[model samples]
Target: MSTNYPKPAVRRLKVYAFDPQASVTLATAMANDYVIELPWEQRWEAPLEKGPVNDYVEVIDIDPAAGLFYAPVDLDDAWLRDGGLEPSEGRPQFHQQMVFAVVMRTIRAFERALGRVVLWARDERLSSAELPPGAIERNFTRRLRIYPHALREANAYYSPDKRALLFGYFKPPESAADVQASWVFTCLSQDVIAHETTHAILHGMRQRSIDPSHVDARAFHEGFADIVALLQHFSMAPVVRQLLAASHGSLREPGLLTGLGEQFGRAIGRSKSLRYALEALGDRARTHQGSAESIAAAIAKLRETTEPHARGGFLVAAVFDAFVTIYERRSEDLLRLARPGLVPGNGLSPDLVERLTQEAAKAADQVLRMCVRALDYLPPIGMTFGEYLRAIITADTDLVRDDPLHYRVAFVEAFKRWGITVPGCISMAPDSLLWDSPRPEEYPALIARANGTPEGETPPQARMDPDDALAWWFADMLKRLQFDVAFDQADDGLGERSAESEEQASSCKVTYTRRDYRSGPAGGRNLRDLAMRVVTHNQRAIHQWLEQCTTDRHDWERLLGVKLTPACARVADVNAPAALRSISGGTDPDAVPNVEVHSARISRRTGPDGSEMHMLIAQIVQRRRAYFDPEEQKAADSGDKGAIGALRWKSPDFWFRGGATLHIDLRDGRLLRVLRKRIDDDARLARERAFRSGDMIAATAAVTGNPREPFAFIHRGS
Candidate 1:
């Protein structure tokens, strides 16, 4: 404890100093951001080495990046002696750990969202290939390089090209002397670090999503990042409890939870925060109006602004409102648990206070889970706030069918207040807006057939399990599409299938392929020839299957309602135009080109109940691939390419990028869900327009414009 260097261990760090915008801060003129010690129960500790190294990330200085920051000089000692880390002795390492801690925390958040480990694109080629499965990390990440002080400026960005987070620092304005002197580091702010980490994680899951295609595309990135960072502040249980107690149990009372980035805001001469959720505009008329009315008016005002951050504000506000509602509803139970005659307005006993804080923490945790899980239900392209609401409802309904607490209702109400609605929903009801389940009868039939249960015998118990339904349904559907349905004999839960039993199961398989196409003229293929190949083969089979699924003329027809279909496909036609636009701005009906079946494997996973949930994970991709040699790309970047080749290079990747991952529940043989990554033509066009207009909002090299030209003043010195 008395050595020249302080040892590293679990220690508390300031979660956030006084939120500058908090009413208390304004009244008290608090000097530093509040710090909280570590060892948080909810915090995830990644596999780390001395530079506080983790498998997925490497913390390094901005220079050559050869060295790493081992640990801060006893953050505990610094905090105990001073209010926070001293700017001169501890600020550098302080900023390093802050970035590392928040980045790890954000990774954990995304893993929760994806329901699996985040596999970065680099992981596929570099580290994973050599490591054993689940061995701490098999190809965790070569190094999602983090530069705590990459530039001398106000902005920080995640560069997909470099696969690194570059935090910039700059001299604080003269007015921000309260926080620091000489410089303000973006890396030092928890919000900025969390926000940038989200971008990296999102890119790993859905890389194409980084494209500035639609208004919501880039805005979704920014807003979703803010949501993660903001919600994470709640996980600092001590801070949240303190603020809640201070605000008299009212989260809406303009406290620490309502604002983000006080230090950054003050450094930039802003009075409150860099951005705020609970703050209302002048037109909001906060004191007199009801909660919903005020939220609605604020949303209306927000809509008048077209900037990505402003639009993202609408999403943040709605979600924040939902959180508040849930917290209030949950507090009701806590109040009931309080001593007799004790109410919220009156000070409660310590026991009751502890109970209230615990309940509030639980509410925040559940809300964060809901937000992350909803991502799996969202479409791969052209997202809108309305679609997000629907995704939330559908995702929640699938997981928790009965919502006694009306959490979904709270979300719907919040969105409705903002006048956001799913385009095709019949009403505002959560039930109506939710993604409809497959017809109940289809599962039984599919499961019965897959299990090869004799006619009238009660389908196997495993088949009766609703969660496993999609697996069998997918098997049956594939058979109908003329696929070879091979029951996984290895899966004992599906029953042993020997060579003899395999032949018997084959009887259930239907092999159908329509092949009627004329030869190409002079060895050249046009759109017409491509259409012939598609309509005559896979498209015809798909069309016939859709017809059967839609109608009830046959015994199966009445039972199966196909809820999924191919979103896009590719055709190879040298004589055809560069690209053929679909009539409805999607995929052409008769053309199923460049379709490749990647893999289809049946596996069993144990459910929370310990029941085996058979799952068929099938992946198929439409390759609208782009092939440009590295040297050619460099030449293009150098502006040395010919007009024709350059024009060709300018075209977008024609083939649909990431394909769909079908999650088929084999328990009851139903299509549990489909996770797809396909292009939306409208969104693609919008992206092109944005590129032309140079209005890209995301922090990525893909934007291809001057980082300063749009607003040079911010980056003037750097």
Candidate 2:
């Protein structure tokens, strides 16, 4: 291979600004086309294959319902590479291009926020017993498969079981307006593509969150995806500017930016978009411009909504309300400067519109970043809207010590108005909701164990505090990761290029690159791939370390909320794997509860004031089998260990999980915080049981057994 081989840093593709319907309207037609510049990396020496397949995602344009295989568009083609195929509903290739572009764009947003490459959820079929001895390598997914036309219905979803995104198409109803096309393709909608992609990204971060543990569990997933898709609209400056001009700088007005799935929503017999953020306020307040009374009314309704999408709408509205608040604050000066006494319905000057657009984009970007960063701070499983509020507050406060613009305050107030409140918080203050930091005195047993001594025995490392010991362990594990994979500097494939680069190769633009790879290895590899390889290779060692330090320690159990020792026997008829099941019919002397180290990654975030905070984030989860019957669960929750142990003889109804997310600062090797959900908490267990046996379950009883693919049914006709 030639050392000087050149590849463009980005491939710009034209996609619909919103959906196909936006292109037909005179108001939005001029701005309906958008050019998405995808970060390009040349993995192979030759040009990309027809599928436009890359490391992150693969676009397989097969219309199985139509019984036809559409050839994938070659994005590497000279003409298409220059400006991409024009946006067209009739063209299958364009559908492929649009989905790829929007999906990649969404992926890039998450990567930027996370400060690390995004990995998809692992393959669900892999079992521990099937693996050979000492082989910790489970099948981690490489590419998220995309089928542009997988079904002949009005739906699209990210399937965790299959590790693929299936988009559908359907004919519009006769009552549907603006019916120029014969069929509506979900793949052609930017909102749908981004929303589904967000689901995949979120699933990668929190695997067990897909379990409907509470009303907010699945609802959080839906609302969060919509939030990402809606906020992404502001990133398109031209679209925002055009909409702002039309609405006279009032984002409160109904428009394409706030409504999702414009074409599909109308086709499904809706008057406007499929679902608008403003509608969360109820019919009377959709046009109320987010008044205090209107938002409170919306909050009251949130308690009554149980459907995933409908309940998720409240979360979306809360986040959108925060964005709008931030935007208004950010653009207040611009509006004042444009005109001292600007009227509500008056048109703004073009320059003022441009300035307002920048402000809106900036606000949206900041809010989106806050939402994404909060994912790291969240508990590994059983997420709630109230918990998400705390995550957003804590995550942002950690990065930006002084919130001069009051970004954290905006989020708190918005969530508070929507009736979202942390369960134990005394007040809605930001500091009151932050996750408690770890204390040295609280982990005496863990510290003693870490020093290689028994509970009271003083060892050589007795001077080391709990924080220092934890930091040391985390640092040691990260050292084993060997993040510095070697790469040839001359090879553009291995170098880090900015996502904003859009110039063609002929322009001879000197693409600025960062040296993320070091000089010690022979092969070029992706950072995420290298990290996963190292972690998986040493999975057993890591698991053993965590289990040994935490097992039988009351302090550790309190801190992490997982039961590690005194493993109860496997329940009868439980569908768990052998490795996950306890060995005996009662308390097992030889068995330790299964401990899974899901992911450990480095987070390097920079504050606005040029301060850098680098830390390691890792999650640990453990599962326990339990019955769904309230009486059985109550007996198990009793203080008697005998009763808890005896329940193992009966058939288990479900697997209950407890987990913790660890945030450790690298500067001084100090433990920052541990966010957890307790495994043995009777209240939580009761809530989960109720949710499982509640109206939500009865509504979806037809799809009860197929929990692995929750998105498949939830996204139908959505």
Candidate 3:
């Protein structure tokens, strides 16, 4: 290796490696120039003795010894992956070491093909004799590509065999830093750069996409990178001295205040490093996400709702939490490995960073690979709260097989309580080199998808038959209430359609007896349990409040605060007021639906038709609908509207549907009353009004025509 006018070229091929320089630094604290200092005990054995690079990847020419490297520039079309990699006390040193591990793994993959050392360096400023023609690079302080929309670069291409990762950022050079961020190395602070580049290299080794649609995806992206980047700071001497002094000249259990950024913070007379944080918080670490409590709340939710950061932003928060644990744990692990009772601020040799970085690199390498593999099966679009739970389950399902010791079991099962299930596609079998599962891809059950889409699969929809739709909604609510009482959990997995069949599952059953109604005027009933669940309930609540609204001759006021004419809440009593009678049809029965006659659970028989029906009954609800069509809306907004069709809820009109004939099922038929009620007494006489879906009601069996004869219970299906 000669340091001449021109640097020797280093072939860029991905490979596997064991950096001896790192090992020496870890085993001893000797001032070996080659052996860099490591803060954590990072020592990992390489998995493959060797591997080869295939297509979708090629060796780029670059000189490592002379500090110059050449690679292709095709990042503009690269897709960003939300690979979920994080550091933990049980694993790598922290964020910085994790980054190094990923980078080293990537470089080794390249080395296997190109057979040379790899160096991450920005483009040289001066024209060198060995420099290629038109090799201009914009630094992170200068540029970060342009138009960073996920749509433009939504698909990343990687070839493990090729040992190449093809991607780019939307970092267009707008101002100085925007331009500077363009260079892969310059886009991040030194630590952040090392961390981000590690992501690139890791992508080439095992292709994956970090979920971008969810908070966890974004957080993991930043957190894991931060951990990796920070650990690398220890590898440099100048930075190490600054870190040690700030740490009060110690290392064991020392907080990050010892790092260079902390010293800078101290120089400015602040408890924390604001400048460094401002610079690092954007794309790498989001630890300063407004308030620590908010971040903790998110983390707690992640833990409670999903396993090992499986759902919500838990996956994202897990990475940072893992970093904290890993940093403290590695510091402790180091004490056990060498010093017995080392205290914080007791500075170790600077070379220790290289050791920690290498060890961290090795630990990071394996975990990241696991993350990459998990991404292939995740949903391509919108991530709901449920999806997050599944993400963690699917991710660690494999990790459980090889490294269960390091990966906690209780840590994972925590998600199951939140309704997360293992993805069937991801089985115990070693997946293809590409790591794909036979995904039973399912989309959410939306009203629009009732007809099914290109996938040729959708939930069965019974269309919007006003009578049927109203009935169905009522039935659904009853079923939900029944299910909630039975299961006692919100997401009991009852509403979720099966991935394969796309059919709704029932944890509880509710059969409708009857329905009847008449158009009086829009009125509302209190739906207390409703707002807790269902989207339509929210709309209904809004409309209910508007019914009580009242107003003056010039300007009317609604009962619940909205203003309108007397027609808003028209009492169906014809004798009350002129407007009331005009709208309510001749003094509609001043009726409070009271069960005058109780029905007995008598013998019920099946008809020729498979559909089961029940005794006569009535149901009610305040139904309102808001429909939108472009043409109609435009005309209405422009004051061109004369008479617009409005969907309004008509109460006082009872809804009745489905009736059944009674038969004695009891063989020795005397009087078998599975359920009973009194009917003879005028005070006891009852007229049963079928309960609407939201109505909390009770029922009993009875004989229809004869008031004296109570319906008998019969033996049915065993």
Top-TM-score candidate index: 2
Tell me the whole-model lDDT of each prediction, alpha carbons only: 0.54, 0.75, 0.27
Task: Report the error of model 1 at residue 35, Å.
Answer: 8.4
By TM-score rank, best first, the candidates go 2, 1, 3
How far residue 663's Cα lies from its native spot in candidate 2, in Å, is 1.1
What is the lDDT, from 0 to 100, of the residue 329 in candidate 2?
91
- Select the stronger candidate by TM-score from 2 and 3: 2
- List candidate 3 stretches off by more than 4 Å: 1-317, 323-334, 337-346, 349-358, 384-393, 399-404, 409-718
CA RMSD, predictions in order: 13.8, 7.9, 28.4
TM-score, each model?
0.64, 0.85, 0.29
TM-score of 2: 0.85
lDDT of 2 by residue, 1-718 (tens): 7789676778889999999888887878987878998766643212345887776888998887778999889987878876699988898999998998999899999988988778888765664445532232356676799999999998899998898999999999988866556898899999999999999999888878788778898899999999999999999998888889888888776679889989888888787888898654443335543467755675678888889998888888889888888898999888778776666667898889999999999999999999999999998979899999999989998888998888888888778767676778898898998989977667777667667777678765455766776565566554444333333224356555443342322222121123224323443333455445444534433454554433545665676666556443223212222122333221133333466667666788898898888887877776655577666555544423466555553445677777788887776667789888876576787788777778454346345646677888888776
What digit string (tens of lDDT, one per residue) describes model 1 on residues 224-335?
7778778877776556666666566667755456777776777787765778876752123355444767656655765565566767777887787788788889888776
